[model samples]
Target: MSDRRSEESSGDEPSSSSISDEVWEQFLQDTERDIRKSAPKEPSARAREVTERLKGRKGEPEGWRTGPAWQEMNGRAARRRRAWAVIGVPLAIAVAVVAMRPSLIPGDPFGSTAGTDTATTPLPAETATPTAAPSAAAPGTPTLARPFAGSPALRWADGAAGIVLPKATALGAIPKDRVELALQQTRKLLVDANLNPDVVAGGRPRAALSVLDPKQPDVLDNLETSLRSPSKTHDPLFLFSRFDPKDVKQAGKVVKVRGRITFAKGKFGGVAVHADYTFVYPVVRAGGSTEVTRTIVRRVIDAELPDPTRYQVTPGRLTLLRYDEDAGNSACDIHDGYLHPQFPSQAPTGSAAPSGPSIDPYDRSRDIGKQEACGTVSRT
Candidate 1:
């Protein structure tokens, strides 16, 4: 589950009940800035999600054009914040469907040359084919919405904004079916527990840690560093610091999260299954001054199911093998989510802190991240 899964859409139609192109493209640019600014030298995890999603589909979208550079990028960021404040997923989009197209990048979605005329003024030869109408959804490829039952308890958490859980459907014992079930369940765990924003928001992470059968100590350690450090300007973004520590005692609440998960497995590993994930969550900035939300995050994560013989269903558990916070669109970001696909090769954007192995998204300004929100204390 790379950001592409969350960034790009499979079909040409605007599954989101035809959300206008302007609104969607603006969001693309705004989120990209969030990624770029998080770690200037490295690509933003969210940008990678946009890039990877468009990698397959290819090119600018039909009738969509980039706006002027003068317009502030955060203008779209503001609109996005408002959009997330509304619902878990749009009426037409499901857990896995995040739309992606070349026209998404402000002036150049694919980093290609820009066209001068409006949609009706078409005459450009070089970009014609690539920007043609979207291809039809391949025939017979069934698309269904996986149901999710949100954790009722989360509703009571103060400062809690909203959450996007994995899409799930009932499954049977068939080997083929088990793999899909495992993948869906794995995603649920990844978004809710493993990528639990509550940890950074100053809430307990037991919900996430509880699901790891063969726990990875790095998970908790990294989270502690991300939560503890204290830098005011470049406040910690959960997307960048999987568990990267920061300095703080007060912070913001997780307002919204955008997540995607894909299942995978095969012969070499004795029929095991695993999942890849991309998450984008927004935080209402810390501090008591003015209650404004500024951080918008996009992250990558990988989870593997334990040996089949020991697998359980009621509460699916998996080994926390890899959690690469802000792991941009590297070829290595995606884990096998489909049958027999090879795992992508992933490397750290930069060296991890030796004294503290997981601190990430180093900000040159030394403005790394924020502390947990009001009314919560460190569990470390």
Candidate 2:
């Protein structure tokens, strides 16, 4: 029994060994299939895992599953991994370079840094300095220095200083010869009482002669009539008289007369003279009260005769021929008081004579019937 048992056991042992080998072969084939399936097509951690698992299975049939094919697969995977590493390293470096490139641009990175360089820089040395302009003065104020201060003959009066008058020698130079000649000729005419001789015989008179004041109203009347009349009744030299006989006969005589003279060019190309005279008379009131009275006597003397129609002697053309003792007298009385004597019975007769405003003295005289009634009450 023992021997029979031994032989049977031995036979069963070969079969068992054969089965174990077949099982081992089957496991290796299954492992190789799993490795092929799990191996990464590209390099990855999964492919490394499969390679390591395949290398651990070294006891399997060498030619069938663990030889050149496996090696070639691992080699290809390593090469693919190396290539990806090279490409990935370069790509990361390229991305970093592109990101940092904008910082290297020309302008300042921070906005505050702009214009700072230009602001800190110094200006060029050749630049010119700016000059200041002069300031203007207020209106109506005089300048600091007078422009014509060097001139000796000019005199400034009224509101302005430095006013120039060629006639005044202090302000300006004047021809003494011409002034003397004019004065001499005027004196001769007054003293001689001759209208026949021309005042300025050869050249035109440079200055005009104006009669400032006459002694009597008759003097002015005669002068006006002689100047206006076609036939010369009295000598023209009589016009130069400073006193009138009628004035001496009527009232106490006065010595000097004061008046104004304005000169203009005459129609005959000579100096035209405008003369105004005021006559002063002494009057005695009640109780021996003596008073001096002034009346205007105006006359216009032109070198050339004027046409009656073209250049009529209106009341406006005549001015006060004498000084007004009372500064408050009406301008019309000062201008037209001389016309009183010419129209003696004008008011009582009610004649429509051209007359001006009457003075209070004349009006009282007319009412009291003392003097000749001269003018009517003013309508205006």
Candidate 3:
């Protein structure tokens, strides 16, 4: 038993010594590895060479740089900033507005007046001149006594005085005095047909008819027939400015007129007077409404005085050559001897439907060309 115990003790001591040695060696190795990993490394060869070169180089003098001055650079930078502020601000705002609401932008910034680079096409004589716009200044509301208020006719001359006669000049064989006589007679006839209160009130145009030469074809007969029995074919309203007494009455005494009387050589070796006039009459409801309305009557007439020495013409009488008429704010198709003015509140009656394009009555820049159908006026 003593020999066995000795052998075991010897084996245990060597085993313990071997384990302690192994553990110590392992710990030393791990510490060495950690130290190597944590320690800073040496500079590369290229880095050391660059450092040496930089350290040995001589520095530039105070103003060696070749470029714009610092102040100029600063100015450029400031200008850039200002440019950004000017353009970027509005751009940012526009973007924000578009994002919020897209419809505020106009579909067409320019209107119909904007023209293209294409050549301009020729327009008709009547359409060549643009229609004159009404007064931009606000006018007073029309009253019973001052019906011409708010109307273009407010600036027109009153009665026959507005019918300005041109300077009498001899035409062909007609003398100046004879031309003057014809003009005076023609002026009287126009006054009788239009300005005369009796004729305008639907009474017989006796003075007007008496001045017309009875020998002329369809002159006196047609006028008489139209006055007696008016129809779409024969309307006396062509030459005469008559209105229905029962429906309306003159609102004021003033009858505004504007026109030019020009004379030229006649067809039958006489003097021809071409009169183009527009008359404005203020009328109110005869049934006692104080509201006022204006009737615009435009007459374009050609009357001639024949040379009694050569032709078998009546003395001191005028011959009707050609005539054209247009009435605004009046009924469309009614052919009675009186004008049927449409009031502001009144809709046209069954017989008053317009068949032609609407026209502006205040536009005196164009001629009343041949219109086959009744037309509507843009305004009263």
Q: Best by TM-score, which number?
A: 3
lDDT preference between candidates 2 and 3, better one: 3
In each prediction, how many residue pairs overlap at the backbone (N, C-alpha, C within less than 3 A)?
Answer: 28, 13, 0
Residues 167-265 of candidate 2 have per-residue lDDT tens digits of: 311112223433333233333222232111122111111121232212222334444543444121322212321222222111232211222233343
Clash count (model 1, backbone only): 28
Ranking by lDDT: 3, 1, 2
The reply for model 1, stretches above 4 Å from the true place, is 1-177, 193-197, 215-254, 267-287, 291-293, 310-316, 327-380
Candidate with best lDDT: 3
Give the per-residue lDDT digits (tens) of candidate 1, residues 1-380.
Answer: 11111233344553655567798667756655443332211122222111010001124322122210111222111100000011112211322123334332234322243343122221221111122211211111111110011111111112212232333333233355455555654545545543456454445555554555433323444434434552221122332323222312112333223323444452212123333222322221123322211122333444554334322211345444333333211111112110010111212232221111121221111111121111100000
TM agreement with the true structure for every prediction: 0.33, 0.23, 0.64
Question: Which ranges in model 2 have alpha carbons more than 4 Å from their true place?
Answer: 1-180, 183-250, 264-269, 283-295, 304-356, 359-380
Candidate 3: deviation at residue 59, Å?
A: 99
Cα lDDT over the full model 3:
0.58
lDDT of 3 by residue, 1-380 (tens): 00000000111222434346577467556644543342111100000000000001134322222211111111110000000000112222333333333333444322244344111222112212334533211123469866876465666677877877777988866789989988988898899999999889999988888888875545576677878998655577767889889999999788988767888887555788888777888888898899787777777777878766555567788876656676666655456767776565554442534445445555566656444445544344
